[model samples]
Every structure is written in structure tokens, then in C-alpha cells.
Target: MIRVAVVDDEPVVRTGLRVILGSAQDITVVADCAGVGAVEAVRDGRVDVLLLDIRMPVVDGPAVLRQVAALPRPPAVAMLTTFDAREHVDEALRLGAAGFLMKNTAPEQLIDAVRALAAGRRVLAPEAVGQVIDGYLLSGRDEDAVRRVRALTDRERQVLALVGAGLSNRAIAGRLHLAHGTVKDHVSAVLAKLGGLNRVQAAVVADRANMVGTGPGRR
Candidate 1:
């Protein structure tokens, strides 16, 4: 079974998530806790996926994540968000979260996201990612990050943006119309150029650099 922990301040939100995730036979809600208990829940419960809320009254998502990231084996973490908390999400992204999930996401989609995350994959749709990245770019400029990203080649920048969006090699290949193997190569090169940070960390850099690509979802 895939173990999942839900961290939210709202009791109703936690309960609602438990019900929704419970419907999946292969996925289990190991612990439904508040941000205060986030680390303890994951550590004690042997969680495989963590659904974290960034808007808690105390003990924010990124703060909890800092503790979790120090664990020998932290579960895949997807921030529980409502789309308006871009800055908070970006902060978490730099600290290394798997991705973000909309609070109002459909039950089926949420289950799928859990399953995918448990399998060590990202959950955002490539098409939808572009618009969110655009938001990050518009939020403000990170001149230092932009300079770091500017050192990359144009194609590398595209690959970096897709990676920042939490896309896998296959999805990125599809998005860029390149072969899967080639995408893997680009990923390796991108990491190398970014001083050998992991994909999610590199994503944070890409985010600050404002290089995450745009999509049709943008108005």
C-alpha cells in the first residue's frame, strides 16, 4: 500500500482528504495531521506521500518541510494550495517539494496524483504548468537566479523550464518534441550546468530565474 500523510490546520480539510484518499484501495492515509505534527506523522507513519498545506495558522508548510527534508528519507511532498499562494509555493519549491496540488482538485485526479507521487513522479499536467510558471515570472524578478539561468543555452533553458514545472523526462520530451533519451541527456546537462543540484532544487533555481516556459492557459 502507498502510505500518505495529510497536513492541514483545518480539521474539515483533513477529514475530507482522508475520505477522498480512503476510497483508493492501494493508497492509505497513514496520518492526517496539522502542520505542528507534520514531521512526526511522516516519521512515525512511514509515509510515502505527504500532502502539505502552506496556509496554516502556525508552522507553515515550508517550515515543516525543512524538518522533513532533513529526514534520512523524506516522502514525496506536494503542497496543498489554492493557487493564490504563489510566493509560499515558490519558497517551498526552492526548499524541494515534489509539486503543488489545487485544494479543489477532483477526487479522481487527487488519487492519481498520490499514486504518481508514490511512484516517484511529478503530477502536474505539462499544459497547465506553463501558465503557473508565467505567474512566477510576473511575480517579480530574481536577478541573481536569472543570471544563473542565462548561462544556459536556449534549448537548455527550455528543458530547464520544463523541469522546473515538475515534468518527467518523457513528458518533457513530448512537450519539446524530442526523444526520451535526448530529454534525459538534457536533464543531466541542465543539472550539471546548475552546479549539480537535483531536479527539484534546480526547479527552484529555474523558478527564481523566471525561465519556466509559458502555455496556452495564459490569457
Candidate 2:
């Protein structure tokens, strides 16, 4: 089972998440806490993933993420935010958050997101993907970032396009009819190529180039 910790200031939010995740067969809520309780809970346990809120008293999500990063076996974190603020999302990423998700996400989507993060995959709300891209562009499209993207191979580019198109690794593997391990290799290559801080950045680049879809929209 994927061990999880739910950290948010609101008791209702924590309770709601527990209810949603409790229904999933593959997940277990190892702990649930608000504010300082969250930090203490995580420090004392072996959490595989953390569902974290961006705003909390005593200690906020971002601060919690920072502290988690310092842990010997840091769990992957999915930041839960009320808004799509670029600054908060960017800071979370810089602090090593695996992804940023909206708290109002659909029940099924939230469950799927936890599973994704638990399985070592990045999961961001659809709307937040655009913010990461737009923010990068508005920040002057950093030259190094462009160079990193340019380094991808043709096959790696194909894989990345599918990823940016919002296809999962398994889906991409099916599309390519390649082994899942091959797909994983290609994804790692793509990330290296884009110097992408994570899969989200690579997707942002794919979305920016209009290589996939009508473009990023609400998730």
C-alpha cells in the first residue's frame, strides 16, 4: 500500500481527503494533521507521499516541504493550493514539491493524483501546468532553459510531445508499442534534454510550442 500523510489547516479538508483516499484500495492514510501537527507527524513516520496545503498556521505547506526535503527519506509532495499563483507554485517546485494541485479537484482525480505521486510520477492540476509555462516565459524564457529543450533527440522529442499532450507513461508506451522501461528511459532522457526541473516543465515546453493540444486549460 502507498503510505500517505494529509497536511492542511482545515479539519474539514483533512477529513474530506481521508474519506476520498480511504476508498482507494491501494492507498493508506498514515497520518492526518493540521499546522504544527503536520510537521511532527511527518518527522515521526515513514510517509511515501504528502498531500499538503499551501496555507497553514504555525507552519505553511511550502515551509513543510522545505523541512521534508531535509529528511533522510523525504516523501514526494503534492502541493494543494486554492489559487494558481505562479509565485507559490514556482517556489514549491524550487523547494522540491513533486507537483501543485488545486484543493477543489474532483474526488476521482484527487484519488488518482495520490496514486500517481505514490508511484513516483508527477501530478499537477491541468490549470497549473499553464501557469508554470507562462511564468517561465514571462521570466524571460531563460536561455539555459531553451538550450536544455533543444538537446532532446527525435525519439525523445516524440515521447515528450506525448507527455506534454498529457499522456501517462503507460499510455505513451502503448502508443509507441515499446516496453514500459523503454518509455521510462525516454522520459528520463527528455527531462535531461529540457533541463526540465520536472515532468511539469517538460510538459510546459511541449504546450508552449503548441506541439500538443489546443493548449493548457483547467484540470
Candidate 3:
């Protein structure tokens, strides 16, 4: 089973996530608590994925993330965020948070994201990502971003495009009719070729290159 820990200031949000994640047979909410309780939650069990509230009131999420960073083995962390927390989320990303999940994410999508995170894939919310890099890509269009995208193979480009569209590795695997492992390999290659820290950066390059819908979005 994929062990998960939830750290959010709101009790209701934690309970709701527990219920949603509970429905999935392979996932278990091993620890659920507020930001102050984060360290214990992660230490109490082997957490494969951690869902943290990005803007918690008292014990802020970024502060807690630093605590996790000090751990010998930190779990894959995905921030629970709303659209307005883009800057905070970006900072969290730099600190090694693995992905993002909108607070209003659908139940099935939440489950899928958690699974993807556990499998070592980023679970980014594309809509929020588009907002984060708003005008920045325009300046890099002809420079770094364009040159990086040019180096990808056709298959890797297809994978990068799907990734740009926020599809997970499994989804990309299905879309491209390749095995899941193959898709993971392609995603890793794309990150390396693009000189990206994570899939989200590679995604930014894909968007600037106007490649988001070019591959799998085609009929």
C-alpha cells in the first residue's frame, strides 16, 4: 500500500482528504494532522507521499517543509494549494516539494495524483502552472526554452507535450500506447535534455515552445 501523510491546518480539509484517499484500495492515510504535528506524522510511519497545505495559518507549510527536508528520508511532498498561492508553491518547489494539487481537485484525480507521486512522478496542476509562468516564458521563447525543446526526440517530444498538458506518466503511457516504464524513461530523458529540476520546469519549456497540445491533444 502507498502510505500517505496529510498536514493541513483545517480539520475539515484533512478529514475530507482522508475520505477521498480512503476509497482507493492501494492508498492509506497513515498520518493526518495540523502543521505543528507534521514531524511526528512523518516520523510515526514510512510515508510514501505527503499532502501538505501550502498556506497554513499558524505553522506554515514552508516551515514544515524545511523540517521534512532535514529528515534522512523525506516522502514525496505535494502541496495542497489554491490559485493564489502560486509564489508560495514555487518556493516550495525549490525546496524540493514534488508537486501541487488544487484544493478543489476531484476525488478520482486526487487519487491518481497521489499514486503518481508515490511512483516518483510530479502531480502538477497545469492551470495553476500556466498562471505561475505567465509572462516569463515569452522572454525565454527564443533563448533557453526553445533550444532545450529542440533537443528532444520525436517520441520524447510527444511525451513532453503530454506532460506540458499535465498528464501523468501513466496517462502518457496510455496516450502514447507505450508501457508505463517506457513513459517514465521518456519523462526522465525529457527532464535531463531540458536541464530541468523537475517535470514542472520541463513543462514550462513545453508551454513556451507551444507544444502543450501538439502531440496527444491531436486526434
Candidate 4:
């Protein structure tokens, strides 16, 4: 089962997430807490995914994410917020958040996000993806970033583009008509070539370099 922890200052939101996620056969709501309680939850080492509210009373979601990053085995975090401000999105991603989900995200999508994160895939709400793309474009592409991406082989570049589009290895395989294992190899090669810690970090690099068309609204 995929163990999940819900961290939100609002009791109602916490309870609602627990209820929604608990219904999934493959997911279990292991802990539900306010901002402060989130520390213990992360330290417990039982959670596979953490659904963290972006704004909280004393300790905010970003601060909590920073703290979790110091842990030996931090859970994959997905920031939940009503706002899609560029700073919030960028900061959370820099702090190692695996996903950025809107508070009003559909119940099934939220569940799917948790599963995706648990399976080591990055997830982003459509608007969040747009924000990342826009922010990168507005800031102008880094020449070094472009050079780094251009160094990749043709196939690796294809894989990196899909990774930037937030497609998991399996999804990229399906899209590229390659075997799952082959996609995994390409993903590893992409990471090694890009010098990224994970898929999310690599996606950020690709975005900054404007390496791929992230679809319709991205430009």
C-alpha cells in the first residue's frame, strides 16, 4: 500500500483529504496533522507521500518541506495551495517538492498524483505546469542550460523532452513506442547527462533552457 500523510492547518481540509485518499485501495492515510505535527510525520519514515498545504499558521508548507529535506528518508511531497503564484511554485520545486497540486484539484486526480509520486514520478497541475513554463520563458533561457541540453544524444533529448512534459517513464515509453525498461535506461541517461538529482530537477532545467514545447498554452 502507498502510505500517505495529510498536512494542513485547516482541520476540515485535512479530514477531507484523508477521506478522499483513504477510499483508494492502494493508498492508506497513515497520518493527518496540522503544520507542526508534520515534522513528526516525516520523521516517522512510514509515509510514501505527503500532501502538504502551502499556507499554515506557525510553520508554512515551504518551511516544512525544507525541514523534511533534511530527513534521512523524506516522503515525496506535493504542495497543496489555492494560489498559483510563481514564487510559491518555484520555491516549492526548488525545495524538492515532487508535485504542485491546486486545492480544488479533482479527487481522482489527487489520488492519482499520490500514486504517481509514490511510484517516483513528478506530478503538476496543468496551471502549475503553465506557471513554470511562463516563469522560465519570462526569465529568458540560460545559454549554459541550452548548451547542456544540446549535449544530449537524439534519443536522450526525446526522453528529456517528455520528462519535461512530466510524463513518467512508463508514459514516455508508451508515447515513444519503446519498452518500459528501455525508457528507464533512457531516463537514467538523461539524469546523468543533465546532472539532475531527480526527474523534477531535470524538468526544471529543461524548462529554464526552453528545451521542449510543454504543449498548447506553454508558449
Among the numbered candidates, top lDDT falls to: 3
Candidate 2 or 3, higher TM-score? Answer: 2
Residues 1-219 of candidate 3: C-alpha lDDT, one tens digit per residue? 999999998889999999999999999999899999998889744999999998888888888898897898889998888866655755676688788778888998899889989998787775567544552343343367568788789999999899888887777888889999999888888888876658876776788788878986476
TM-score of each: 0.75, 0.86, 0.84, 0.83
Flag regions of model 1 displaced more than 4 Å.
83-87, 123-141, 164-166, 175-178, 195-219
- lDDT by residue for model 4 (1-219), tens: 999999999989888898899889999998999999898987979899999987787998889999998999999999887644554555676688888788778899989999999988788776466655544445454345557788888888778877887777887888888999999998898888765646666776776666657422343
TM-score of 1: 0.75
Off by over 4 Å in 2: 134-143, 214-219
CA lDDT scores, all candidates in order:
0.77, 0.78, 0.81, 0.79
Candidate 1 lDDT over 1-219, as tens digits, reads 999999999999999999999999999998988999889898753899999987788899889999999998899998887656655755676677776777777899899889989988766533335434544455464345556677788888888887776667887888888999998898888888777666655675676666555521222
Worst 10 residues of 1 by lDDT: 210-219
Tell me the tens digit of each residue's lDDT in model 2 across 1-219: 988999998999999999988999989998999858766677855888899987776888778888888887888899887754555555676687887678788989988888898888988788567666655565565457656656777777778778887778988888878899999999987887676558877777787666666322313
Candidate 4 Cα misplacement greater than 4 A, ranges: 133-143, 208-219
